[model samples]
Each structure stands twice: as structure tokens, then as C-alpha cells.
Target chain A: MIENFKKRFQKDGIWVLFLLPALLIYLVFMAAPLLDSMRLSLYTGKGYTPTEFVGLQNYIDLFTNPVWRERFLGALKNTVIFFAIHMIVQNSLGLFFANLLSQDFKGRNFFRTIIFAPATLSVLVTGFLWTLILNPHWGAINQTLKAIGLDSWAKPWLGDENLALVTISLASVWQWVGMPTVLFLAGLLGISDEILEAARVDGASSWHIFWKIKFPLLKPVVGVVAILTFVDNFNAFDVIYAMAGAKGEPGYSTDLLATFFYRTGIAGEHPIGIPNMGMGAAIATITFVILMTGVLIWLYSSRKNEDLV
Target chain B: MSRTQKLFTYSALSIWAFVAIFPIWTLIVNSFKPQKEIFSNPFGLPQNFTLEGYKAVWLKGNFGTYFLNTIYVTVISLALIIFFGSLAAYALAKWNSKSSTALYVFFIAGLMIPIRLGTIDLVRLMQFLNLQDTIWSLIPVYVAMGMPISIFILTAFVKNLPREMFDAAKVDGASEWRIYLQIVVPLLRPAIATVAIFNMMKIWNDFWFPLVFIRAEESRTVALGVSLLFGQYRTDWTRALSTLSLAAIPILILYILLSREFIKGLTAGAVKG
Candidate 1:
């Protein structure tokens, strides 16, 4: 066994040289910190230092303690609502657009470029731009509504508590719908011309063909898109932070786990904000677990589906 | 398709396209308008195109410095990600051992787990390394964050290369390193471009790491700079819009020029994986 191992090492050892730099960097920066953060979550701390191991007390507080629980549950509900909006509004529009663009329309590339343009821009730019457009005073939406004789329709979209979360979700959907559209378009294109042609030869209408043939084939892509959206929405922060500030203002209506984690762990409370690194780490660990579990379940189920197929 | 269906498609596409471009249009138009004009006619074209907003942001806000800093960070990080990622991908693709499979899985796992969750300890780690608040601090983290997808994409590309070439090189007495440097590196150009473009977008537009890791003014990237400017100039609509336009316009122009490559790189990984 030793001789066999030595022979294998001698043959493949050069590969280690190639892998070492990235491995070292990823292990140190990405992997190590993840473990350390999980460890930190088990301890209690006042500032940046974790002094005592109160194993899982932080997690307990995250669920039971009123303040932390309120914020956590609120952020979790908002996050789910955020994901639901994407799954419904953003993805449906993406599919509709993908279906439209899939037709051999003139200037398809032009339209594709225009639609996907926002996805490439910085989230900060998108958030800032939308904040101006949605601003209650002298903002374009309100002014346009007034101009068109719907004077009472426009409100402070980002400033109203009830409307804030939905408004931010809509703005984010506006920026990112193109991603799923492009992905679905790719999936649409993957259907062979022969199959489409055969379906056309039949009396099946385009709608029937899409529903009966194309949509079924696109299930895998749909699953992938759903999982991607789930992970991304759960991890979302930049757009909300850019628009509503870190507090997820308008009464924390737009607070996400990401922003809440930022507030608790990194930034702490404003003006005499003592950093609750332990609690923050707890939040981060919870987020990590939820995300991993979601992805693993999707992976396992998708693999099972493939086997059954 | 029927005439009505065609018309519907056209109208829907047109409306959505308009919606997509409207915010950006507002930014550009309002950035040039005087403040009072923007307030009065939010949707109208600027009465007169003015460079004052741009000038103020460029000179007073020091966006020029932030722009250069962003470019520096983005380029350096992309270089490191592509170099190390391609090397590691090449090894994993060619070695074809049990350990290679394990390593591939390990790296790809980074994709599902958002690295930002580890921000708490990452900050502590950076402080321990004495690298906090420096521009150089971002490079390693970005490289590490970007490696998983880079390695994943490049490995697929490497595996597609003809095997006889490597076998022939081995027979010619060329060392593995020389072969990789001379033969494999050159052949991986398309994959490198794909990886570079993807990483460039992420590292260029990333705000989270730069926000947490760097607080010093000298190290602020464009995203952080623009966000900070927006906060400071909340009521200065013209200047705020101008700063956003400055941050956005270059990327929009690049996207237009390279939309095909950008879309291809983005969709390629999704379709395959």
C-alpha cells in the first residue's frame, strides 16, 4: 500500500503545485473564515472579541429573545416575500419575455441587449437610480402620474411601511429579471429544430406546443432558476442597503437576513453601537445553514428526478 | 404568428424595453439638467445640457480617484483569479485522480455558500494579517470568492481539448510545467476570456466586501464611492444622479460593445451546470 501510494504521488505530484496557490488562498480566506465564523457563533462577545463559550445560547436568543426574534422573524418573512415576488413577478415576466424573444423577431438582439443592460450595471447604481425615480417629491413616477391625471395614485413608494418591501422587491426584480430571461432563452434554444418542426407539422398550436412540449423539457432549467433565485434572494443586501439604508428603513419592513447580519455583527447599532459579534455570527451561521440545506435538498431531488427520468 | 400576436409581442417588448431603459435615461437626462428643472419636469428632457453636475462630482467628490481605484482593484483581482483558477483547473482536468474529484467538489461548493456570511471572521482575519483597510486587502478575498466558478468553467474547457496534443508533448520530453505554460495556457484563451469577464463584473460591482473591509477613503471602489456620495448628497439630486451616471455609463458602454461575449459567458455556465 505504501509503495502504491508513493507511485501514485510520484506520478501526480506536479498537479499539487498547480493547485496549491488557489487551494491555500481559498482555504485561508473562504473556508477557514466560514468555520471560524461558525465557531464564533457559539460564543458571546461584547465587541469584536469572543470571550466565553456559551454554546448555542446565541442561537437560542435568536429565536427566543424578543428583540432579536422580532428582527429575525421580520427579516425572514420579508425575505420569503422577496423571494415570492421574484418567483412570481420577475420569473413570469422573464419567461414571457423569453418566449417573445424566442420568436424570430426583427432586432431581437437589440431588444435583448436593452433588456439585459440593467443586469450588468452595479446594484448601487440601480438602487440609487430607482430611489430617485420613486422619490415622492419631484420624482418621475409621481410627476408622471399627476401629468396623466392619476394624481392620487403616486405615494412615497420607498418611505411607506406597507409599500416599502414590495417597492424594493419590484426595483430589484426590474434589475435582475433579465438574468432568468436569458437563462430561459438559452433553455428554449436548446430544444432541437427537428422537434419543433415536427410539432409544427402536427395540428398543435404554438401555445399547445409550448405548454405540452417545450415547458416540460425546460423543467430542469426552471428548477435551476428557482434554486438560484432562492439562494440569491436570501443572500440579498446591496440593493436594499443602497436604497433603504442598512436599517431596512420604513420600520424595518425591508430588512433581510443579510442586512440584519450586517447591522448586528459588523456595523452594530448607530451612535454608541456596540458590536454584537457573537449574535451577528449566530445570524450568519443560521443563514449559512438555511442556504446549504435548501441547495442540498434541491440537488438531491434533482438528482433523483434525473435517475427516474 | 398572427398579426395581433406579432403586434402584442412588439408592444410588450417595447414597453418592457422602455421600462428597462427609463431609470438610466432619467439618470443621464437629469444629471445634465439644473436642479430646479429636474424637480419641475422630472420626466422631460433637460432644458439645457450642463456639465456642472459631472464637474462637481468629478472634481469635488473625487470620483476620478475612486474610478481609478476601482479599475486597479478590478484588474488586479481578475488577473489573479484567472491565473490561479486556470492553473488549478488545468491540474484537476488533466490529473484525473480520486483526489481531483474531491478537490473539484470542494471548490464548487463555494458557489452555493455565499462567502459574505463569513464577513465577521473575515474582518478579524484581515485585522490579524494587518491587511485591513488597504486596497491590497480586497485582492485575495476577491480571488478566493471568484475561484469556484472560474475553476468550474475552466475545467470544462480544459477537458474539451484534444488529448493527443498533451500525449505528443509528453513524448517530446517537454516537462509538465513547460507544456502547461506553452501549450495548455494558449489553448485556454476562450475559457480565460469567459472567466475574466465574469470575474470582472463581480469584482468591479461588488460593494459588500469593500464596505466591510475598507473604510479609508483612499481604498474606496466605485460602488462604495457612489453609495457614499448618494448618502452625503441625498438632496443634491443633480449631483447624485451625475455620480451614478459616472459609475454606470462606462459599464453600459462596455456591455453594449461586448454584449455577445458577456451574455455568452453568463448563459454558458448556467446551461451546462
Candidate 2:
């Protein structure tokens, strides 16, 4: 029995050492805190430490309480819009660029490099850069419009409540379009050349080929791209914080779930100027649930069909 | 193939290319001009060049220290993630067991979820460990955050590796560690490069974690520092542009130098192959 146990230990020991470091760090640093934050959401705290367990009270306030409810719903709505624009504009442009690049082309590498350049820069930098370019009175866009004698076209880009979210979302789309471009390009390249050639031999145009054949094959990648956009925009913060400020300024037209959480939980929310840790955790939990639901759906759907990705 | 198709592709691509390059061009060229000139000539090349913005950024801020801090965190976190991540991935690829399969699924789940959700408890965790407000705090968090994707990519790469290589090494009486180092490590260089570049972009350019975890001048990262300076220098366009250019230029230069590898690396996570 002792010898058998030793043999089993010998077989296990090396793998255990290999796995433990990453696993322990992942659990203690990332996974545990994520789970604990959910638990902490149930209890209100005047400080860092929660004094009382108010089970589900924080969530209730988040849903029903006037102030929290408005911010939560506003952020949720804006995130959806932000994600929609990314899906429609960024991914579409990405597919467009990918289609163009996948064809026999000159300077394809150069264009691909230029297209993806913005994504490498910090979102804070891009956010601030766009804030400068989109400045109302003296920005590049306005100045160009004025110079071109289309002065009427230039308006408050970031200042308007109606247009601010779209403007920021476009800026974000501009920055990250390269990602989906690269992804789609890979998917496009993966299409067996013979199949596309056969379609062309049958007199199919590029448009029909792209929509009818290429797109259906690219579904798995699209799902990946969609879930990526969802996770990113749902928690989108740095862009808004940098462009619009942490309060999601211009009357909070640009507040995202992440920035909203920052204001409420980490920094004190405005006016009352006190950190509500529990409420912030509640927001985080909600965001987590939304993300998990989106992910599970994608997973279930993808599992049903053999993915090209 | 047709004239019209080629023309449409070139023109459309050229136009989109311009849209892509224009803002960044404005950013870089504007930084070199003086304050008044920035507003006057936002579109033109710097007619009269000035290093005033760069000088002010250097003198007025801990920009140098923040730059170094970012590098330190990125390198340390990357080293940990690669070392530990590769080890686990190697075992997962080689070991045929139900537990390994289960563990692999567990790590891969992190790819879909954002790590920011844990900031509430993470803040407390940092404070509890006396790591809050220190650059030391960022490393562990980043390594942990990097794990899932690193494991996801590396394990796939490793699993695709030839079985004969591992068997041959073992047949020659090599230990698992020996096989990993001598055989696996060399073969994994490309995948390692992919994982490194991916995580480097995240760690180097991240603003959120630095904002939450580190506040001291000594501890601030390039992203956090730039954001702070942007807030302070809102009205001073020249300085703001220069500060941004400073933070952005290194990675931009890196991207330019290694565009092919960089593009491939960034897409590694999404593209299964």
C-alpha cells in the first residue's frame, strides 16, 4: 500500500508543480475576488468593510431606487447602442476591408499595418486624441470644415447629449476595426480556394460570393467578434473616462457600466460624494451576469454547429 | 480581375486608409508644433518645429519614471505568465487525464469574462495584502489576467506539436522537465512570441488597473500618467498632444517594425489556427 501510494505520488508531483503557480494566482487573484465581489454586493458598507448583510437589498436598490436605477438603465442603454455601432460599423468595415485585402492587391501588407495601428495605442490616448480632434470651437474637424466653407457642418461633437455616445462609439470603432478586420481576413483566407473558384466558374459575382458563401462560412468568427464586442462595450470605461470624464459628462450622456461602477464604487458618486461599495459591486455583478448570459448563448449555439473558426 | 473592380477596391481602400491614418497623422505632426501653431496648422506639417511640448512633459511630470514602471510591470508579468502558463499548458497537452481536461476548461473560461468585475474585492484584497497604491500590486493581477488567453493559445499550439518529439525525448531517458526545456521551449518560440506581444499590448497600454491600484508618482504607469496629465493640461493642447505622443510612440514604433508578426500575434486569440 505504501509503495503504491509512492508510485501515484511520483506520477502526480511534477504535473502538480507545473499547474499550481498559475492556477493558484488565477484563483486567489482573479477568480476569488470576482466571486467575492458578488457576495459583497449583498451587504452595504459605509467603508471598505461591510458591516451588515442586507441580502439582495443592494440589487433591489439598483433596480428600483430612483438614482441608481436611472444611471444603471442609462448606462445599459448606452452600452447597447455603443455595442450596436461597433457591430454595424466596425465589424462591417472590418469585413469590407478584409474582402478588399483578401483579393490580389498591391500594398496589402502596408494597408493592413496602417489599419491596425490605432488599436495598439492606449484607448486613453485615442480617447484624448479624438477629444482634441472633435473639440467644438477649435478642433481639426471643425477647422477643416470652416476652411472648406462648410462651417454649418461643424457642431459640438462631444458636447451634445444626443450625438456624444455615437461620436465616442465611432471613435472606438475607428480604433478597433482592425481587430475584426484581421479576424475576418483570417476567416476569408481559410476558405478553400477551389470552392470560391468553382463559384466564380458558375458565373457568381463577388457580392453574391461574399454574402452567400463567405459569410456563412465566417459565422463562427462573427460569433467570436460579436462576443468580443459585447464584453468590451459592456465594460467600456477608459474611452469614456478619457473623452467624457469619469462622471460620463455632458449630463452623463456617455456613461458606461464600467465608468458608472467607478463613480459609484471606487470613487464616490457625485453630490453625495461617498463611495457606495455595495452598490458598485451590485453593478459589477449585473454586468457579469449579462456577459455570462451572452457567452453561454454563443457557446450553446456554436456547439450545435461545427465552427469554421 | 475587372478594371472597375480594381478601381473600386483601390479607391475605397485608399479612402478608408486615409480615414485611418488622418487622425494619427494629426496627432504626431501637431505635437511638434508650438501652441498657437497647433490650432493654426492642425493639418499641415510643422513649419516651425518646437520641442517645447516634449521638454515640458519631461520636466513637469514623472513621465520617465512612469514609462519605466510600465516596462517593469509588463516584463515581470509577461515573464511570470509565460513561465507558469507554458508549464501548465505543457502538462495539459501531454497528460491524458480527466482532471487535465477539466482544468483546461476552467482556465479557458476566463477568455470570455472581463477581469474588471473583481475590482471591488480586488481593491480590498490589495489593501489587505498591503499592496494597494504600489506598482508591486499590478504584476500579480496582470499575470492572473493573462493566464486564460495565454493558456488557450499555448495549449493549442502545444497539442498540435508532434507526439514523436516528446516520445523520442522520453525514450532517450529525458525527464519531463528536460523534454519541456530542450524540445518544447524551442518549438514554442513562435507561440511564445504571440502570447508575449498580446499580453504586452494589454499590460503596457492598460489605464484601468493602474488607475484603480496605483496612485503614487512612483507607481503610476504610462497610461495612468498620460491620463492624469491630459486632465491637468486640458487647455494646453501642445503639452497634451506631446504627452500622448510620448506614450503612444513606443508601441507604434514597435508595431511598425514588426507589423507582420504583430498583426498575426494580435489575432492569435480569435483565430483558432
User: Over the full model, what C-alpha lDDT does candidate 2 score relative to the true structure?
Assistant: 0.90
What candidate 1 gets wrong by more than 4 Å, as runs, is A1-6
Which portions of model 2 show Cα errors greater than 4 Å? A1-4, A271-273, A307-309
lDDT (10s digit) by residue, model 2, range A120-233: 989999999999999998898988899999989899999999989999999999999999999999889999999999999999999999999999989989988888888888
DockQ, every prediction: 0.86, 0.87
- Model 2 deviation from native, Cα RMSD in Å: 1.4
Q: Indicate the residue-level lDDT of B157 in model 2.
A: 97
Q: Tell me the interface RMSD of model 2, in angstroms.
A: 0.8
lDDT of each: 0.90, 0.90
How much is the lDDT of residue A259 in candidate 1? 91
DockQ of model 2, rounded to 2 decimals: 0.87
How do the residues B139-172 of candidate 2 rate in per-residue lDDT, one tens digit apiece?
Answer: 9999999999999999999999989999888899
**Docking band of candidate 2:** high
Interface Cα root-mean-square deviation for all models? 0.9, 0.8
